[model samples]
Target: MQIDFSRSIVDIVLDHGNSIPDRTALIFDQGDGAQSSLTYAELATRITQLAGALSARGLAGRRIALLFSAGTDFALALLACLAAGGVAIPLAPVGRRKARLQNILNMLGDIRPDCILLDDSMAALFGDELSAALAVGPVRYLEFAALAAEPHPFAALTLRPDQLAVLQFTSGTTSNPKGVMISHGNIIANEAMIQVAFGHDQDSHFVGWVPHYHDQGLFGNILQPLFLGSTCVITSPAAFINRPMFWLQLITRYGAHTSGGPNFGYDLCVDFATRRGMPDDLDLSGWRVAFNGAERVRPGTLDRFAECFADAGFDRRAFLPCYGLAESTLVTIAVPPQSDPIVKSYDSRALAAGRAEESKDREGVLELACCGPAMAGAEARIVDPATGAALPDGAVGEIWLRGPHITAGYIDNPAATEASFGRLDEGAPFLRTGDLGFAAAEGFFIVSRLKDLIIVRGRNHAPSDVEQIWSELSGTVGQASAAAVEIEMGDTQHIVLIAEMKRDDARALSDEKVQEMAGRLRAMAMERLELAVTDLVLVSASTIPRTTSGKVQRKQAGRMLMDGELTVLAMAGPLAQAFGPSEQGASAAGQSALR
Candidate 1:
């Protein structure tokens, strides 16, 4: 009954029944504080029978897609696919992107899996042969539970360490997504490193509403628990977005020791308290690792969150600043859990000049939070993006990493792989994070986004520079009113602006005054920066899409502008044609979580 780390984890499940069988490996919460449990023994027996089922149907080594709701079934289906040596293409909730179930089918069709595993509800809607034909050609549908009932074929197969275990799709910078090829070795290494860095163990538990298909949720919330023999409670992100308190309640209910998300969750929770009467004295003392990452790590967001939850007994020390990308398998560096998050303030102009210059000027000073140091064996460096020369300490440059946990490259993107991961001036090869940050005397802090900048006419401009302008505006919380992205229209760079309206100003001022304010802001941007902002989107307060930590989802906002759904100023001429008034906020219909 020895657990084989090198073989299919399904094989390892065979050992679960012999030892620690009754221990709960997963806790499924339905977001309303209701819960269900699945022990290691129960999960192992089900997966074993499922592997037997898939083998009975000749599904071994065949590709299968899992379009599922977050539950024990979702986890079981994925493990079953792997136990039988079938490739699992998981599709989880991602906001608005998978609105139409047909789009889900199309993405799955691209993979052309032999069969699809779906929840009973999803099967009712998209599983009909007629809809399946219309959805994306003929892909057979199978209920998740059906697999567990199949007779035991019991032809156990072992996976080579290099064989593909999970073929996760990464939302690359490009419009089209690319599959991130993860081997058995990559998955195994990430879990082991995560177990050590994050202190995951059998006694530990994870509660997340993060999208399961994304690397962060899949690896951190789902697989990390599986590898460490702990309990993971996962729910759909849409559920939490609908009720932000659902996250806290889950932690309180499950006694979850660990939970984290992007900055948006913190903002949303605060906004909820202001708008609706949320429970005080919420009792989050059981929370151990309450870190936040995924995008910009905001100091104010953390402070505000700690202050908000202080009455609820949430410990401020549990808040940690961590950083990672899909390229590195979710985490590159994590500040020791509950460490005082470091914030490095810098000069705006000098930083825009491709030189990270530290400044103490209280006015207009930008604070970038520390993402801690590298994990055990991982190495990190800050290099000048232009010449690849290693930058001195205190200088902001592109973040590069080399580690056992890092993936080699995008599956088939040879050009990008070559451009991103390669030999650095420091002897060995490294993967460029395409992120702008400095290794502070304290450790890693991403100051600005490398590729998220814009060159208007001839001046190098950072979107954070514009975002900072919105920050100083009276009555605007840090990210309440700013997302700047340059849209390419012919040869020149056309700036697309998405800003949040101050509630007081929106309520008190006339529509004309609001328009005037927006116009003045645009004019100020042009005059100060010498850039023509083609469109201005004045959204209602608290509408901007930011990670749980405060990084703006500029690409998503840009997509909204490109679709003419973002309404800022009047749609006039080119601006009117591009920024149509769609008026869909964060929680819109047809929106599902990320895949």
Candidate 2:
């Protein structure tokens, strides 16, 4: 069942509708005991109907945002946009807060979509803000139900392979969001690469709860199944967040062959299993490929997940640690099926010097998991950030990639497009991933981002290192913590700790307790990292800013602190003295690097 890459995805799906019309294409769980199923023929017909309505409305070549809360509606609307020759923009449902709505407005200002597609329920949920937002821009709203009921004759799709198919908005970890311009050919090439990398076919069944608005969710779960002519069982992201067990239950019930999410998702499952335990009859023997992507893959998280579920016939070898970004259209590197994830140890000191030396002993070592080799038809290289020269294996540098799977550029942002897609000295085009990693004989080891690395006294420290130190005080500090830096006069930089207050600490707020916790944190920072903490700001849970993929927005956090937006529960150390270490504190600080 080889696919014709020249054909549009809509055409491929239509071919499936003709050859295997009765096959279950999509199974969506509503999370309320209600489920929806769509066969290929049924899906093709619905897509044709809605596409006809869109084409009648002259929406071809326009940008259309899909904002449905229901997975079924979302899938159909996305396909209809493609079939109608319009670029699809998958957006999260409108939130309630004014700030959230303002964020939506800001994105829309950049996108300037010609129309918005959503269901009636979402229309009601948006209330007056939807109308007001529409009034501000030249846009129209189309209800899915109404569009499906239209009787316009179906028109032939006019999309070309080079034409834009989607505007995938980045998670905004570095700055404001930018829409990655993904062409139809980019999707086709990546889908084929994923199939080759993951060993996916029509026999594979996928069960997932990652949000469809995300890159992993859109490319891995939803589109991969359709591209392979397979069945996809999907539930809302809220379902997994509320109860991660639901995801495992779906995999078990559906005999799903592939599934996965970020490292935090596995941590959540481990935490749930530890507290509530798993069902005695749960069976995960059919689960084959468990992909861990979209974030850092912690070595401990993999070990714990394996130990927790080994009793239920879950195989540790099924773990597949992978890495990619929206700029690459989803995945670039991935572990092959039926192989165990690669884990290695490196000297932390050498890593700061842009080298990856295998640690002789466990002491002062940093453990990293391999994200596998480059996918088929894709090539990756390590380049020195300062010199733009390619680095040899075992030398940490920026990850550069080149392949047909790479995206075109950002929409309406030539400066960003040029900056990210600059040419190498060898006269070859490569995408600068902005990630720090080193290639080894086994695979690539992803280190912290170049931007997220903190420089203290001319020493490099990953934010995770600082956050891990602060979160060890679990009783007083929450599990989530962010490490930020502020630069003052004389080119001096000082570390700032922003963390959530533990539930008990927030409930029993007192100046003495706050000061006590702050003092302990400062002491621990000095004792462990040997760095003087300038200030410790304790905030409520969910106050610290984070991207959609759960990565901390350190730059944004710094801005909030400077603007006095964060409610500070406690403050320690003199702000001005941060530039110059005090003699009293310097005398107390020891020589250690997070022992």
Candidate 3:
């Protein structure tokens, strides 16, 4: 397949529509044995029709908010927005939660989109809230059916390389979500990078369940396959979460060549297999590239998943650990296809002190997964965040990137854009990832987010390191999640370990058992991480807040803990004194503290 790098995605789609009209473009698994698909000709027609309608409404070059669930409609809406020469802002469908509705409203306000494309279901769900929010502005509400059903003749608009294509909102794990300005050039360059890195071709097939609102889903799952004019099978994140096996089932059903999600996804699959067992007909031999990214890639997750699915012909070498962000337009560093993931054990103590010293001994060592070298046409540098000087290999520092794939800046936020995207002393522009890591000859190793790092008594600890310890200890109880956050109390920063126990475990375990588990967590943190846990709180499952991409929102969790928003099943340590005696008391105390 010959790819013209000079053309925009819109042009490429049109070319594919003409050349491979009967080729399958997308297959959506409904997760209930029902499925639907579209050919290149059908996809192109829908996109063009919708685009013509949008253009007729004078929405060109305007921001259009796509508020639809992950499915064929959302995909069509997104492509139409881009085809119409409008900036597509894909947001998750609004839910019943007032807070969630407000967040969507807040985002809409920030971008001030000219129109919102949704479906009847979404309108019925949050019509009142949306109406009230948009009543204050001139934003138009356009339904997907109404737009796609209208017949309109349209010619594809030629797009410039630097023209803004999409406004990708950050997950807001560390701070308020900012819209990353992704240009047409960035998309084309990134798609090319992904093609070379993953060894994808026109014949390559994809099966993905990651939400389209996420950068990984939008770029890696949706656009990457389209760029190669290949078939892509997609399912909703909810479907995957409800049954992790469905994801593998789709890959097996379609003999998918590429598919992946965050590290937690791999863990979920391992858990599912352990509990329910894999189907006898399951076969993953054709899955050539299982790219893991959008969050910290865990070595243990890769190991467990490979071992669990080994019987189904899963290849460990196919595991590709990647590192990327929306700011970089999806992927920056990714392991080469068919290569064994690099896992090096570094001295935990040395890592805490800003160095990646290889540990010969197994004890007290952190196994870091190497998210391979910079993508083609990209350069990665490890620099001291405080000093702005490039650091030597094996020294932990901020990861900076420079490449055509890198986004221009945040939308309408000059302050943040200035802070994150800037030029180096030598006049080369780079995007500061705000992630702490060290680069070795093999590849780049991500340590932790700069904002989420827990500093205690002059020692730095990654929350993931501590959370991993808790996860291992709590596995016997049930499916548990942990959040290790740093909270400031009277001029001192303290580590608060919050564990979310599965509902069954929370109900079955006595207070004594919960306290024992908390004590074990503290001891493990001290022994393994050399850090003292100031307080430990045990809460019911789903207590820890997470971003849309399933990353633990440590900053938000920390704030929630301070504000007493988390429901405490049990508390350990001195902090318990603040929440006197009972669960009800803790809630009242938290409310009072806020006042």
* TM-scores for every predicted model: 0.85, 0.90, 0.96
What tens-digit string does per-residue lDDT give for candidate 1 at 94-205? Answer: 3353355656756765766788778776666556742446455556667876666566856667777667767777654423565666766667766676666777677788
Q: What is the C-alpha lDDT of each candidate?
A: 0.69, 0.79, 0.85
Flag the better candidate by TM-score, 2 or 3.
3
**Each candidate's clash count:** 20, 0, 0
lDDT of 3 by residue, 1-595 (tens): 2334579988888789999999999999966877889999999988899888888888877899988876778778888889888999998653457876887778777788899878767777777778777776878877777777788878878888899999999988899888999999899999988899889999999999999999999999999999999999999998998898989998999999999998888888888889988788889999999999888888888888899899999999999999999999999898999999999999988999998999878667889999999988888999989878999999999999998889989988999999998666675589999999999999899999998889876778999888888778877321228788877655555688888865566667787886787788888878777888878887767777877777778878877776667777777776677776544325555445544
TM-score-based ranking: 3, 2, 1
Better of 1 and 3 by lDDT: 3
Worst 10-residue lDDT window for candidate 3 reads: 582-591
Candidate 2 lDDT tens digits, 1-595: 2334688777878778988899999999855888999999998888888888898999977899887774777888898899888999988653456766676667777788999877777777664677776875598867788888888888676567788999998988878878999988888889989998999989799997888888988889998999889999999888897888888989998999999988878888888888898877779999999999887788878898999999888999999999999999999998888888788877777777778988867455677899999998888999988788999999989998988879988999999999889667565479999889999988788988788777765666666655666756653221235555543423445577777765566547665676676677767666544556666666556667877766678878766654445655555545423322211221111111101
Off by over 4 Å in 2: 1-4, 135-137, 425-428, 471-492, 506-535, 571-595
Off by over 4 Å in 3: 1-5, 94-97, 132-136, 476-480, 585-595
Ranked candidates (lDDT, high to low): 3, 2, 1
